[model samples]
Target: MSIVIIQGPHAHGLASGELQRNLQPLALAAGRTLEWFRCHELRDFVACVRSAKRRASEFMLLDPGELGLQAMAHPEAGLGDALDEVDTPYVEVHEDASTELGIQPGQHHAPVATVIINGDIGCSYRIGLGIALRQLDDEGIAVRAA
Candidate 1:
């Protein structure tokens, strides 16, 4: 299975590295391929999401960070719109509770299977990858052997 990770502005630099390190082992264990894209701005976020759509990833893990909340607050930002276009199952991760960003479960403007690990970034990716692996397995999708 192939999965793409889209990191929002807040996940730049060190945070991005940490997320990759934490997600890699789990992805390998699941026999899944992982790709990552980091967005430093709303435009970058939109473009990366568009690229993911083009790539047709089987699953997506997004940590939209502050940019996502900002986009939700302002439709003109178009980040939510970009996300809405993706048909792949997705998991949204947040380092803080959705309420802190004025969001709530089932209220995300995009279609996602679930949101995970509200206050814990490291654990979020681990759990997100597990969810993806399970869903893929349930669907009888074959994961490449590591």
Candidate 2:
């Protein structure tokens, strides 16, 4: 399957490169394809989702990071609305999301997301991608187009 991962700017010094390193190998070995996009703004986040959906990717992995706060602040019809309109099934990703970290869980309960995966840095991305790929496989969706 082909999945799109939308990553937001990390807070608390988590490096974004760590996620890619973990996910890319797993995907390649599984005969899956991945597209990773890092978004620093709400508009870019929404557009990346639209781009992924338009490209017919089977699933999306979203890690809104610090941007989650921005989304929660405007839940009435802002980023959440954009996500709803895009209509791509997504799993919310939280890297290094231990409660001891005290990060606000803004998008955890987002209505549009299929699931939320929280784990150590880099680990959550791998797990979220696995879950998304399995969900699509369970649904009998074909692997990504060549």
Best by lDDT: 1
Model 1 worst lDDT window (10 residues): 99-108
**Tens digits of per-residue lDDT for model 1 on 48-92?**
876787897988887777676666677676655666677577777
The positional error of residue 115 in candidate 1, measured at the CA in angstroms, is: 3.7
Lowest lDDT 10-residue stretch of candidate 2: 96-105
- Cα distance off (Å), candidate 1, residue 44: 1.1
Highest TM-score against the true fold, candidate: 1
* Deviating ranges (above 4 Å) for candidate 1: 11-14, 98-118, 141-146
User: Which pairs in model 2 have colliding backbones?
Assistant: none
Which residue pairs show collisions in model 1?
A: none
TM-score of each: 0.78, 0.74
Per-residue lDDT of candidate 2, residues 1-146 (tens digit): 68888887776766767767877888887677888888888678767866775778877888777776666565542565565556677777775343111222464224223333454646666667778767776666544542
